[model samples]
Target: MAEHTIHFGILGCASIARRNSRAIKLAPNCSISALGSRSLERAKKFAKENEYPAYVKLYGSYEEVLDDPNVDVVYVPLPTSLHVKWAVLAAQKKKHVLLEKPVALNLKDLDVILEACEANGVQYMDGTMWMHHPRTPKMREFLSDSHQFGKLKAIHSVFSYNAGEDFLKNDIRVQPDLDALGALGDSGWYCIRAILWATDYEMPKTVTALREPEFNEAGVILSCGASLSWEDGKLATFYCSFLTNLSMDISALGTKGNLRVHDFVVPYQDHVGRFYVTSDLGWAGIPEGADPPPTVHSIETDLPHEAHMVAEFSKLVENIKSNGGAPETKWASISRKTQIVVDAVIASIAKGFEPIEIN
Candidate 1:
């Protein structure tokens, strides 16, 4: 750890793994040392197509990646169904884990994976890029300001994309066995995380799924919405779908202010991210002279949000390896809280759209 960069071994040739591989290349403290897939040809093709260095090892089985003595971290971008098994195995092998979301099938499964990471003293983090975005903290800073933005009142989030007929039919995301949570797990995971983040990770008191969720054949969700409320009257609603055009929106209202972000999941441009904020509304009516426009805050970054996420996670791993430090529990807790809300929403829908109390 003193003078060596952390080595990453990706356990799957999934589409998302390509992005993580690129991020590792961008991270100063990390390098992609190996690639693994069920088919050795697929792994070799991925490595060649991605222009990995000649030194990068290719493995036919994921377990080989876990067994590699030089692999310091295992990036598991496999489907939700495969997450628990490979992620747990990687942790048990004493390798840090960077897992893709919808971390597991449910909280019980998620807890088991988390316990494995804890027992092995390895860091656990979901590949949620926005949490590492520079603009996210700027929005939070405004939300936390009492004089500018008072108590949070409500939040509305939407994330969706038109996946078309072919993807709907063949994509693993919409397949019941591959990802039973479907749209709720794919798009809705970010919505739930955004809401929980804006609330400072406070668990909602109750979660109610909106009526009339759309589903594909084989009983997988295609689109769904949910409402969450707190004891103090704070409320949040989120919509996620595979049927709509690409859109990611967040509208947050406070007693004295409002915040809006059109692209919260992935920014329109990787280098620059922007959000709108309006504060201290003296009166609902027109202002004294020409009404002032809402403040537009722009944050510039050298790397994309996903790359930042990789860098942040790599730094944590380095700390543990170099300083003999314990794994940070904050990232794991955030992933768990997001999964908890996701579970409640799914439960509500299954139980006739009835309100499910968040336990």
Candidate 2:
């Protein structure tokens, strides 16, 4: 390894690169050293606008950036369909990768990414930032071992936002050939990831889906509903939509009580209120508001940062430096499973909501 900071390179000038570029500049051990794009003018323009260091090279072609001997890691923010190709090339170039989410369109592409990373002795991590947010683990901790929620019987979750006619009017998210998994792949993946994380369920035994026609062009499922099971009797339901205004909600039902998280998706603003439950005295709030029993403990915490991407990126770099690999098995496994469930759901919808086994 080089003695100076881990010299980084960016593969595209997408909006996401703008966000991660901030973190790259701030982190002590990382620096964006190169910018690559299909267009030379665009590459130079992005580099100039971002004010990357003077020595940071700009390249007309992605290959030029990867071919550069000094670039150590490549941050890929390409469209979902393009992720696998560049990721494989990055790995083949012996560069570490922080790939954008949906990791790839399907399992085959994901496998290629994994193989490329392994072959080149480089590390790879999907940019599914929400999975690494401290808020999620905190939420899980609060729910565990609690009579307030008894034993969780079922979980229902929803995450959606109207991308509006503007996106459909121009963006590839609405293009049929490009919109393989539909909005579900783009935004709904989180809803699936969060629910599976909270319940710690194995791959859903079966998946069914419902999606609107407009999503055919969006490269995502505009709206979807899926049901999943863990063991013999545990069941869960999840939904995601792009046709409606934004929402982030989750409800965990229990034998004795339930827990609901309002605006749980983005975690950008300060959220109050307790994890409410039905109690002996009637309904009561716990955590940030209302009164609670001595036996019922409440937790008050905030999901800081306007975005969780930086936090996860920081953790990813630190973990690789210290532990020589990605996060624990449960975390990595959940990421793969997240993609798996989305794939199954899309397949089901293609077959008219026919149930598909996850395996």
Candidate 3:
């Protein structure tokens, strides 16, 4: 363990927070300093349930966590609506923020959070665990190799899982006031991020919601998809749903090659990741075994991706605290681009599935 460990304070007891709590503990340079909720008893119960150390503080309100001098970072797993409020305040308090995904309900609110973090010199990172995985960079190396991958042409991504009836009816994700973007905000965030990442965060020329998006009685999205195109002839499409079997994938095709990954969001198993790539395509099979085969590449890591995210965040915080370094803005910038596309998707759907121009 590092001598200068950073303390993490959680501001909510959301189920996702439970997963992150474990991750924070798994990180060598991070430790849970506090857990806060609307109910002190709830915090106590959660601390016990999660087997947190007895020395960890418990608070009845989120403000207490922000006010704690021992806390160096705040992990906010609150709903989308509350993100703007808590995330901005955490930044203003000069605590780095690790926020849950679907960064905000809209780009405007997201900008507010980003501005706060920038103004306060606090790092801001959305909870996209896969971004910290070693395998992601390995895949990126291939995508960036023009000689092998050539000019990128198209990309397809899908992230979906069957939310049980209870979840569909009662989950905050399905509620407009809590998580207005719903399925698009929840799952589609990953799809959009994947596409933007593959394109080096280039803004799409246009975004068109494909077909129709299903909505619940409250007008929250349940399933949605969108297509994005660029002037360079690069195109991408993604689908996200709360009404499908478990599936997470990304397939990108270039003029000279292509790559595919079945579990891009979360690996099928912890600590191990895999992707396939094939480069060569003048024509189809010319004879028996004539076509090239995809090379299977797999990476095994010491810790799960979530824990890796925590360790990476901690390293950045350590640099800022110990070496007088500025916070890394790349994470927040990527998140903003992802949210821009997300807002475009919402607009396209609102206009009756018309194409929404991206500026």
Name the runs in model 1 displaced over 4 angstroms.
Answer: 1-4, 282-292
From the highest lDDT down, the ranking of the candidates is 3, 1, 2
Q: Which scores better on lDDT, 1 or 3?
A: 3
Please say which candidate is ahead in lDDT: 2 or 3. Answer: 3
Q: Tens digit of lDDT per residue, candidate 1, span 139-231?
A: 999999998889999999999999999989999999888999999999999999999999999999999999999998788999999999999
lDDT per residue as tens, model 2, 169-214: 6565555555466667766777787777767655667776654434
Error of 2 at 248 (Å): 2.4
Model 3 steric clash pairs: none
Off by over 4 Å in 3: 1-4, 281-292
The TM-score between candidate 1 and the true structure equals: 0.97
Tens digits of per-residue lDDT, candidate 3, 1-359, equal: 33238999999899988888888888888899999999999999999999988779999999999999999999999989999999999999999999999889999999999999999999999999999998999999999999889888999999999998999999999999999999999999999999999998999999999987889999999999999999999999999999999889999999888989999988998879999998875565346765557788998988889999999999999999999999999998899999989999998888988898998
Model 2 segments beyond 4 Å from truth? 1-4, 27-29, 211-220, 270-332
Worst 10 residues of 3 by lDDT: 282-291
Q: Give the whole-model CA lDDT for all candidates, comma-separated.
A: 0.91, 0.68, 0.92
